[model samples]
Target: MTTAPGSTRNETAAIGDGLRGNAEELLRELAGPAARLRDDQWVAIEALVVDKRRALVVQRTGWGKSAVYFIAAKLLRARGRGPTVIVSPLLALMRNQVAAARRAGVVAATINSGNVTEWDEIHRQVASGAVDVLLVSPERLNNPDFRDQVLPRLAADAGLVVIDEAHCVSDWGHDFRPDYRRIRTLIADLGTDVPVLATTATANDRVVTDVAGQIGTDTLVLRGSLDRESLHLSVVRFDDAVERTTWLSGHLDELPGSGIVYTLTVAGAHDLADVLTSHGHRVAAYTGQTDPAEREMLETALLDNEVKALIATSALGMGFDKPDLGFVVHVGAPSSPISYYQQVGRAGRATERAEVVLLPGPEDTRIWSYFASVAFPREHVVRSVLEALDYERPQSTAALEPLVELNRSRLDMVLKVLDVDGAVRRVRGGWLATGQPWTYDADRYERLDAARTAEQQAMLDYQQTTGCRMEFLRRQLDDPALIGAAPGSGACGRCDSCTGIHRDTTVDTEAVAATRARLDRPGFDLAARKQWPTGMAKLGISLSGKITEGAETGRVLGRLNSLGWGRRLRPVLDGPDAPVPDEVVQACIPVLREWDWTVRPTAVLALESPDHPVLTTSLAERLADIGRLRNLGTLYLRPDHPPVSAVNSAHRVAALYDSWEVPDLSRTDGPILLVDTLTDSGWTFTVAAWTLRRAGAPAVLPFALATPT
Candidate 1:
């Protein structure tokens, strides 16, 4: 739970030609920021400057997460601190750090995106000790060309390396970058003595340990509560977007800080920004397609409070900070709950009360469908890409695309698909492919597929839940419990989930009339679940034993089979022929029926699906009832974040779990409680459950704790 703040993790330096003898004093004299270091910062500051070994300090955002880099640079500039290089996943973040360092009167420059003449000058300054930190994106450092151009030419192999957004290194991280995996080799190429400092805000234990391994550095993961207590989490569910937008406009006037309106698509972001602007809200529109300067200007305006709100896509946040942000409202469901958590986290950075809101629409399905279509590669395409690689040195997604006669967009989709499937990984963009991509075992794929399915179920649950959306998310993450419930609020309030906002079950009688009006969808607006205003109930079971939780694969085939009910299980197995055994099903049938009533139909339907291979004995073994809770990052390859697994486990163990909660867990009262437990494998899932408890709900909470490693 404790890790060194991003600071000194290395201790070797060769002074600028003539200054070796007095480097320490000279470096200290040059480093001066006497006022900002309050008593609170002293602990982190001293921990970093006092030694050149490992240490971790978790301070809130705006408290100077960047200052740690400056201090480290000063130490490195001193005789003993280490020659340094910082690899960040976010270019903006790196720029911010470099800017901060230079502002502190410390010389700093970057070797990314732009040309070499500048890099060479910066390199000279670094070697001469005029510049203390050389900031680069993993793209530049991992580039064989970039490395060849710079590494040997530097003063010495950088003795200190800091990876900002360290979570990217973990395959399980929310923001996984293939290039990050190659960092281990870069570190190896740098020599073993170099101590690496890794920093990130969203990582859990799994991410923390994975990062340590990836960087080959003793980890310093400084963790705090996943819950941003100052932030009040809420969601708005509406019959349609018209209702959503109109309601949002009204809420915007009441919220103190300017709000962030998140849309699922770039076009949606543009339209919403325009609409809000027309309504007299000086709104800034942001998305990936935006020009850098424009994005900068708009973001600056928003941060400066010059505007009342900003309407953008999810691309607006990550690796950037806006502490004054008061609220974030999603217009629709994101592809995954993890995406939701990140967007919501952007708000409430200020010390005052903040709110996170969600407004889901039926069109969310279209959004998800689009994401799935583009984000993941088709199976045949994957086969083809791997086949194409059979002869060539691994190529870029573009090169492989034409050979397979696919378009760039299609090719990119396939690549992303394979990445999540872990079937093929372009770890260093183009340089690092899984050495044996074809060797990916069927069992592993099935296991991962099952994990994804469970995650999807959790998302659906949050979308459809009728209670507090925030609380539902937390409970699924298995946070400790909040108990002692009081009574429920009777008013519908402004949220979409209130029964007042929607109609009860309908008959087919209105189909013709609804069709005449070109009404949204013919069937139930399943996504309507996000509107429930009150909190949630908590209950889920975690399967134990037969698998080492913290290991590379935390699967329990035996239990999975037992639950499948005496039938052939087609788990996404690794290797050529890891099919489900017949004998395993016989043992599972009796257990399946006795397990939970809702479990049978879903399990059967899942078995009939094309992706049934994901259902192994332990794959869907965990099951729990939907408690007032929320969850995410549960199914990733991260072992540090346990709440995600419990949700997945709950899906496997639950009597019934559905995507039907509305205004999930906003009200209802009880002592906040979360279920903290682990799988037989020693990986932990924490946080989300507790966040759910805080939102509201009174029910049994459970998490399958990992056995101690």
Candidate 2:
């Protein structure tokens, strides 16, 4: 091994001792008083700092995985090594890492979508060797400017490369992010002398195998026990949505400390947070739709224990660090056991006897099916994306969207898959075909899909398991220590099944009534579509610019995914064709009475619904009778038009361009009410409103019972 310049043999031995001292000092500074490095942590750090070899640490969360890299970076910098590069997955993770680095007296900076204006200064810091560590998201690896201009230099010069949440790089991992796959190429390009470290808390054996194989040759694998001593795991299954809502409302305050409440959908997150807020809890909703600034603020609020909880979706999962988080309660079960374990692992990290509960809902499977549809694109979609590319001219994703039916995200994923297969390349302008042979691995994708289905089934099984909850989870990860826990005695002795100590199942009658009342109350605005989607002309729809005359802002009882009334509304909207339900009719009365329309609808005009004709006609007739208005004959659909949601906005507008006609109106000059079953893209309502206005109606008020997210 080569030593640093200007160092003799005794000086080198002294320097080694100094390095150990430095690591110990930094560990205490980072982990606080009485902090000592675990043997496994020292092993991984030595392999990186002394051996200069690749390592994979698959320990549970709060296992001091960050400490290994931070201390290694500090020691390496002292030896004149270049700055360490950490490829993390979430902005929350990056934020935590930067703060942790600062406490250890290490200079750190980040380049992500949130800090575009500071990129130049950050780059200058990197150039000057003033930054000890640089954190970036995986997606930033594929940016045109970063990929072409900056990545090469970083790859060759970085002293250490860390892939945090490394399980995502494998296809078999629970949270398989396509952007993380780009790291394979980055790994292959790095200098052999540059030490690499990949750390994850949630990988099973299969995922660990795949990630280790991809990271490098002869990688050191460090696997630790998955047991979390502080967590008391339990499951509480409810017969229906109301019971679940009542349970959460009745027992939220009783949970030990400030933590996270996770939901399956954004609408669910918002609805649950709203219910909790009305019941006088300090809470906020966090999801993918939340603004970047607000997400940062919410994260801080949770860390400081300023709020009791933050109702959120999976967006808040992975790499959020709060050591003292008291509990983690799931409103709906995630589709996979690994995912569930990851979320629950966030709690009980630094506390004794923290509660982890799963309030499994009856709708979890249906929600799983909804997300499963986007798991992987069909073979035809992939082929179309490849076919659309030309070898000589690069075409941007937006330009290719007009030729292919896939959405932007799905297309981007297909392009990435092709890029990895060497069938396509991303150039200066966009993507171009490489004219290389590529085979779609039908069997591989099938296995992946089947694996996902099995994971979903495993999650369901977990809820019904009679064995130790923590033991079952560890076994799912193929933990080798399970054999030592005694056969048939793997129970943790802390779960509800083992201890007979469970949450109170009783619900307060008033709380249930209040929750029901809030759900039953109806009112959500259907903001009129003000502008046409761009590129409509290419789809044979000439209408462009803003629509000055269209449907007025309207109302729906609630979103289909909303906790309030959603359970009752879903069946009515999804059920067989029949007259509107009497209960739904009763629900709409309040919405009608509370509507503050500029012009009262004097006549009714029902939009044609081949699927729900009876519902629309009955709704229109009932509303006209109650409001004392005339029932104008309904508009008819042109033959051969597909359902509004069957395609994208451009195609939806094209199919409905000249598809509706008002057969006869008793009062053509008066404002009219247009009823439909549901609204998704709102283009259907837009075209219908334009048709009615052109047919001489003064105004149109659109109404629906539900709008899908």
Candidate 3:
């Protein structure tokens, strides 16, 4: 870090005094970046080198996580021990760390494939015991020769092992690199009785725990709250792409400074760049393929203010530092909030107020009947990967590829993929990446991402939740580190909430939304819905109740008779001859109402006496559930039904309410509950809420449980 004549020495001494003259002096003596370390950073380094505890220094992107390891290495070296080995993921980051180490007079060398001729230097540094830290990718850890020779020697003197961006160990991380599993094995084999330091800017509880478990770190947790007070968050709704583009064009010159526009896909980056360029905004696109020159151009342009914004995927921010990113925009939904955060974090680097806009399309959903067939490989992949791991030996991608029945080539391809994009290198002969690529059933491997689609769908659902975006993200990350004030609450005055420009007046749009909220409260009806099992139960068991072609009259009557529910709706689940208890059937009723049936109108719209003692408290919940119900494909009462995609289907479904028995008016006065499941029909919520209010309910509180969407 730059300093006046002796500011480096002064800062070093001050930091040493703060750390009681532990590792701080060594770290400061070797500091090289022009960007001086902040006080908190020194504390973090002290925590690492002084306490000698495995540390995780969680910070926003570009906050200099690499420096922590570099500083730690010097102290380790000063102890007359060997240099620490940093198992880094990104090549650019590795290159940068190596250079920074050399500049600071620390013996640092990397063994990436980019420099095959440097092996002599690498071997010399290793044998000479002159290096302070040997930077290697996870793949390098698997090399038998290196592990047997170079690593063993280093391990004898090793004092610390650092795993950067440790979240890849968790499936919840943005890019789950499978090669990460081998890291623990590598650490164990290295004989480095050193504290393990794992660090990442964005990780939830699950990721942190998973990393700790994988890396064998102690129980100490390093957590940073997810609140970036400097960043503003907003969501814009659009049903038309053209309209979205037009709206985005209007904001092309936001904040009049450097910023980033992150897209879900590479094509999106190019297209958005083109669009912004057309709108007279100085923009450049940076995807995985952006050359070093182009990357340099983008980085320099941003720092020089030559370009107002960088239209790119999430890859543009690594290895570069620009303190003043004015804003960030998302043209499409991010793969996950983790992806969203890392990309959005590019802006507001200067700790200045910044803006982030998330645009979503509101659509009416009509189930195509095929959604049920969607494939999910969560259980299968987890099972396969675990089984495939050679728990005793290294988990070689090559050896494990053929054992799986799925597409071997694609399986191997996906299995060897590393996290955070290019963090894991392919060792020259390591079974994981350098071995012969497997060949097998191409179909299975071809659709690996397809298998993860279910997870993505679940992610999409969370993104659309209307609770609190911060809470949902926290849950997904499962990292308790993110539990604090709700994000985007406008407390910072920079967020969209504070600005009021993106305030969702549409949340409680229905006239009786408050009534809907009341109906959502717990009561007998509400409890009944809770008892219902998901549709995955066995065939007949999965059926909630029978639906009689165009009507459910006899079915309800029979069930009620069977359980004596009709005898008296007074909480009767005690039938003597009933195979299922009266309470069982009673509890199953609300859930049964939700089951899809073969009858034209598979579900019967039935309501209980809301004012009744048993029903009074549960009234709002039942009504809210009903309001959230999807139109399900409409049943055709008329002999001649319109095509599946016709207006008549919508009309007939909307009119079904006219034929319900025992309509629970009080239930109609509740917030909609079931709407969360219907991604395709967020707008149907409005229509249903409007219909319910007209039917007489207290109020309709149609909140989607705020999410990152």
Ranking by lDDT: 2, 3, 1
10 residues in a row with least lDDT, candidate 1: 521-530
Model 2 ranges with Cα > 4 A deviation: 1-18, 427-429, 483-486, 640-645, 664-666
Q: Rate the local accuracy (lDDT) of all candidates.
A: 0.49, 0.86, 0.51
> How does model 2 score by TM-score?
0.95
lDDT of 2 by residue, 364-482 (tens): 89899988887668788788888879999998886676567766677788887788778988878999999999888999999999999999999999999878889888888877667
lDDT per residue for candidate 3 within 195-239, as digits (tens), equals 667778777655666676666546356555555666777777665
As a TM-score, model 3 comes out at: 0.54
Q: Tens digits of per-residue lDDT for model 1 on 1-709?
A: 1233463333222222122233233334434423334443333434344434443333334444555656655655564544577787655565566666666566667876644568767766776766667787776654555556666554255756777766677655667776566566566665444555666655544556667666545645454334455666555566645445656655677777787888877756755665565556677778878876677787778778988887887767665667678877788777566556666767776656676676777666655654554433345656766666532255665445435534455555455545444455553345234545444355644654555456566777877777755545444333222222321222223334533354222323343233222211111100101111111122322323242211111112221111111012223222233333444434333333342221122110011112223332122232212222223212222233222222122222222222112234444333222222222312222122222333343421222211211
Q: Among these predicted structures, which one has the highest TM-score?
A: 2
| C-alpha TM-scores of all predictions | 0.57, 0.95, 0.54
Cα RMSD, each candidate: 22.1, 2.6, 19.8
Question: Whole-model lDDT, candidate 2?
Answer: 0.86
